[model samples]
Target chain A: MNTTLTERILGGDVRSAGRLMRWVDDDLPEARHELAALYPHTGRAYLVGVTGNPGSGKSTLVNALVAHLRASGKTVGVVAVDPTSPFSGGAILGDRVRMQQHSLDRGVFIRSVATRGNLGGISRSTPAMVQVLDAMGFDVVIIETVGVGQDEVDIVRLADTNIVVTVPGLGDDVQAEKAGLMEIADIFVINKSDQTGADRLLRELRTMLHLRPRDAATEWTPPVLKTIAVRDEGIDTLLTNIEAHTSWLSAHGARHQRDRTRAQQFVRLIVTEALSHRLNHALASSDWQSTLDALLARTQNPHDAADALLNAILEPR
Target chain B: MSQEPKPRTYRVLIGKPGLDGHDRGAKVIARALRDAGFEVIYSGLHQTPEMLVRIALQEDVDCIGLSILSGAHNTLMPEIVRLLEAEGAGDIFVFGGGIIPENDIGPLKEAGVRAIFTPGTPTTEVIEYLREACANRYQ
Candidate 1:
């Protein structure tokens, strides 16, 4: 009567899933094995990425979105990412404060992760955690990244629907021309739209979208919507637009393409990590130390030393 | 490939349970724990025992640190431990802080709370106790 953790997760065990998520964050080998077994059950849940600047109400907006989704009878999971301290390596994950209303709901699972040292808006183990949630049969998995402005486009590669949230007074319209967040957004949200500059921001966004070069007849135009997330205003419209994007993705065969890309990226990252681990192990050996000594003595040049090291590790002994 | 596995980064939930609206003490402790390299999930103010236990279970944290100042620690602290035990998560360590009377500490600990730090206790003491306590529990 021994049931595996993977089996328990598939049987709707929240405790098991929560433990696996912790294992994933700790980089435990058992977690990898369980994830390999659980991979086949994934891809059934829709992944939504929500990213915005600090103080932009991303968590509030996510709370509203989750409430709306629950009203429609869908199970939800959230992976909220917060930044770890570069000096102390600790993090205060306070996103759950905004999301306390859903804490008692069995159908909702929320997990917080620290970025550790990852440069992207997400943690290194985010995709794996998403897989755990997906396998656990959540209808929708929402990823709320650490507050990011521009140049954090990694969410585009993982999420089926990438939503870039901006507020009215952040000068986002001009910053959008800088080319990172603007290009990665599948949809744009102007939260806190009751503020003074809401209309100006909206007009600037529309003009920018209009000026962009695209095949308007066939391409999917990213819609710019407005919302006051604290009052839960416009969340229903936002959810409808998200669903519209989901359907458009399936109808245009983009979902399959995205799935393939995600798979390829995941496999490549695994290989890279394994190779990096092996290289670090090799570099700690006496032979590599001798090489380092020779390089310090200037008898072996830097390029030659690197070549020898790579050859020693990559070649089958 | 026989290297030792990395230590688990113990996560602690700093919850302000019951009707206590003043959370400055909780926030200070949360920041101190973060500086000591423990991931701290702050539940903000006005949380019930049900909500705190639910968050602790979902986060899979190693410890629950309840901060209360409204003199309801006797009722609220034990209720959290009971709810956590009911959910089969009794192994998760529970601790408390804030204005608890010296008389109530023994009963709270008897009810499965491992430790309690009263007001004016140094933040480093809490961090050190957690490190030792959690290491023993997990090992």
Candidate 2:
């Protein structure tokens, strides 16, 4: 059954993926090993990361993109990352209910991952999940974010193409400028074009685009396409722009870009892993939890005490 | 006389159709189902017609509870129902519940949806309906 699970996943079996996701969440060590073996089968799918502020119509835009891709005869996989509430530590994947049209399509797959305090805009398991999607041989993978914070921007580094969706009337343009959003957009989508100020925002976006030397230019520079995703208006142009970007990246040594991104992903993971190990073995090995009580009681200096714990770990065995 | 203290359990597949990202209802329903003792295999969001059918086949699930809030139900669900029939999963029961309106209900039911749960329908009602459906299917 276990081997079958892996095989079915490779075969793009939906039940298999659902079971595997749970296995991942449960931290089954074997599941990790099995997935590692499946990694090479990935790198086939074109990963497109879509990010923007919360309520920027990212889900709606993604829905349109998926529809376009399906119409063009491509299988798609989507990863929607939502923030886990700090107080409850539970995933609020409410976003999944928004794009429910593909429920019956065999060629599309979507999974929601919780950003469990992961700083760079995803849960630790996200990149791996994307790899799983890629291995499943999806023609395209769309990653929709919880929002476009600094962490959200970081998701761009993992994708071959990054689309930053912007809406009008939310001061999103100014926020985008302040957040350095323009730096990462491969294609900028002005959604809700029916609303006024979208054209103004598009002009501002173009003006911002003009000021910079192209980050990675090819046959096509990043284009700003206007869309009313709710009405499914203007999605084809946006999708065409996305295709343009991907082919451009492929011709421009997407391999090197992927390596660069993958290296950073691993580095982040390793550093977090090492630090966590240090906390678990080096610091928590001591009577640290109670020591904080003493510090709270003014009997010890937390700074010195923290240093002592680190020093103990540094001493080794 | 009825038997005392019956063991209540239900099985459901919580599925998503197109690209709608409003899964708040699905997640809440999944939790409610789990608490209600139904083993749920949630297919998450953005599932294509084929993927959902594939899942429904393998899980051998009794019920497929689709959560469609995207307003694309007309374009999506009929295709799924057709696919399910083609795949010989025609015996499996299918229903939908979400932000659908009164006007859309008759068409959905006409398309062979067992029942449609709209907003304000309690989770208990869903559980009870499933329990009855599963029993009827088994019988």
Candidate 3:
């Protein structure tokens, strides 16, 4: 059954793809069977991350970029991740509202994901979701994230090219120089460029780049581009730079390096989750409950209890 | 009922179809559903029945709410349910809202619309209905 569904998804059945993604979001045990089937067919699509602070026009920019990509005959998949409501665990993925122009396009597929209380705003399922789109034959996959604190940096792990968007007159220049945003930005976009402080924001971004140290051997000159995404201005230039960056990745073999780093992080993430799950299972025993009681009673030190738990877990059962 | 409750992430797609451009109601319902703990995707104005169904399939929404005010509910609303059935997605719950007349409600429900929300219905009603309708869907 899973293989048939996987085949259908690979054959461009959007329904099958959607069902699989829902399974992933719900963390169903059966999702792994289909994901394993889809794994080998992934890795062909270009992954781009669009991130910026709230109200920075990331959605509009991504919508324009999707239009541009479609005009050039590319099939695009978009994952717009929004913060989850802590109370209800629900999310209003308004990014899909901004990009609704492409909603009916057969060549485009857009999925909105909730952060689901995941720290850093980007969901842990995003990379796997992108792989699903890639396996489904999207030429490009764009992950647009709510760029709250740490989100801009977290997206770097998933994207082949990361574009950090900001608006003018928002005091974003000082915010950009705060280290995290400036470091992960492969392309800096001053969206709403027709606004008052466009030029100043552009200059500030340039100055920050100049002040930052670079590796002379493989220095990527991250271009600062301006765009009024509502009017579709500067979209062509943005696409051109994206193409150049992809080409640069291939030319310098940095794509492989990036993939290797992504693989390492992926493995580490899975290992950490697995270890936590196993530890929790081990700690559920009556012996561990006694240990906890001892710690609470101040009969055993925390370090000694921790060593005992580790020894218990490591011992052959 | 005494067991611990698992986290719920029910996805609902709210669509506005046909030429009637009033999306305020749709947006309001979408937000309400979001606040009620359902992931809501609002398909903006002027979506076709085909487009709505496609969005539902691609989005894997558990339910679809179509809002139309062009008095085309007789034609458009049933067409969405038909498409869902034809696409082997009949299990996907279909509902409607708009300036739908009282006379048309029975036919819409017969055509597989589980419920309809007219202009003055409270948002909580829809949320409450969906919670029960979609509860038993998952094993």
Candidate 4:
């Protein structure tokens, strides 16, 4: 795709938007250039990450949330990360089967990504992809992780407001609480609230929240909103809670703090890229296979070997 | 232990486009392709069509597959083909699979999408198709 098409995508061209994401996914050489061109327009969108365990009804919740945002005339972009099979590296039919209902809405764009051992249970390139959406002027970007527990928690690091979802029938909410998902959530959604045991789960969640230690200095308490998302019941309340959290973050300057955290992540990406570049250029010239063999054989520590590689990068031929 | 020789590497790029964040099939297909001895570069979910085409050009892959369960395939797939023309990836074979309606399959293929693998497509079909398509494309 040319710069014109990339620009057209930022100008709200649907076709261009689709193409831009592909470039990022494929890690095309043009990925950086295309994203950089669109970077100036980003930082305007509100990024929200919705995550929870599988069967927590997060997709339905997200659907309701998208409808809420679109009704308010916001352009919404959704990134759903599906779990990859351990052996096949292929996606299971989860998110794709979940939200094919909104195919006609022009304001909503949903892209499903497969997570193939992206260590940390999140897509390694997710943050950059979010920046692409933000840059494209999506008023709201909701990133939904593959609701597979802790691995899905990486959404919190990439999102501005991470919403942790839970449901009634899933045993104890404490498992979620103990996982510290409760700690990262700006808004906790109890979906499928119309179910019989909904109230019990809510009570358990509240009880855990009570017992959990708070960040002594901060007065902001994350709200727990119950919803029957499929019916769209209480979604407005969830939206209201989200708005409240966003307003609170802005008012308390916590949004900036989150931005600084995101900035560090970008820094980490750059450092990783530079290190890889240096290493591959230098060590790739060495017997990379033998070197790896030596390391695996416990003859050399990775750090020392890395130092040796870095030295090679600096050393003249 | 007698190690099996690595199969001849065939690289494919699979992408999801435009606001459809459902990627289960894409991941599965990518993984299956990898295990079948093809080197795969997967763009983690939610890429646009323009992004996919550009990546196909850059990675110099043998094939490009897309999973679009969002039903925007009509609007998005054509755009991918158009961009592929610009990037000179017109020769790169493109295929898609997902919640595609049976009727839309005809149009998708007419737009030059080589194949449309819907839900329930056996992974073996994909591996076999790629082996054939890549051989022919290269030849």
Best by DockQ: 1
Question: What tens digits encode model 3's per-residue C-alpha lDDT throughout A1-317?
Answer: 45587999999998889888887777777778888999899889999999887888999999999999999999999999998888878887767778877867989999888899887658877777888999999999999987684435778888899998888877766666774788888899989999998998898899889888988568788999999999999999999999999999998999998888877877787677666766887889999999889989999899999888777776665
> Among all windows of ten consecutive residues in candidate 4 chain A, which has the lowest summed lDDT?
A89-98
Writing each residue's lDDT as its tens digit, candidate 1 over A1-317 gives: 29998999999888788888988998888788899999999999999999978888999999999999999999999999999999899999999999989998999999999999887799988999999999999999999999967788778889999988888777756787684777888889999999999999889988998898988666789999999999999899999999999999989899999999888878887888877887998899999999889988999999988888788778774
Residue A120 error, candidate 2, Å: 3.9
Task: State which candidate, 2 or 3, has the greater lDDT.
Answer: 3
| All candidates: DockQ | 0.73, 0.11, 0.57, 0.11
Global lDDT of model 1: 0.90
lDDT-better candidate, 1 vs 3: 1
Report the candidate with higher DockQ, 1 versus 4: 1
Stretches off by above 4 angstroms in model 1 are A315-317, B1-7
Count of clashing residue pairs in every prediction: 0, 35, 0, 35
Q: List the residue pairs that clash in candidate 3.
A: none
| DockQ score, prediction 2 | 0.11
Candidate 2 off by > 4 Å: A2-4, A148-151, A213-221, A287-317, B1-139
Global lDDT of each candidate: 0.90, 0.74, 0.85, 0.74
lDDT winner, 3 or 4: 3
TM-score of chain A of each: 0.95, 0.86, 0.94, 0.87
- What is the Cα-based lDDT of residue B15 in candidate 1? 98
Give candidate 4's error at residue B95 in angstroms: 7.6
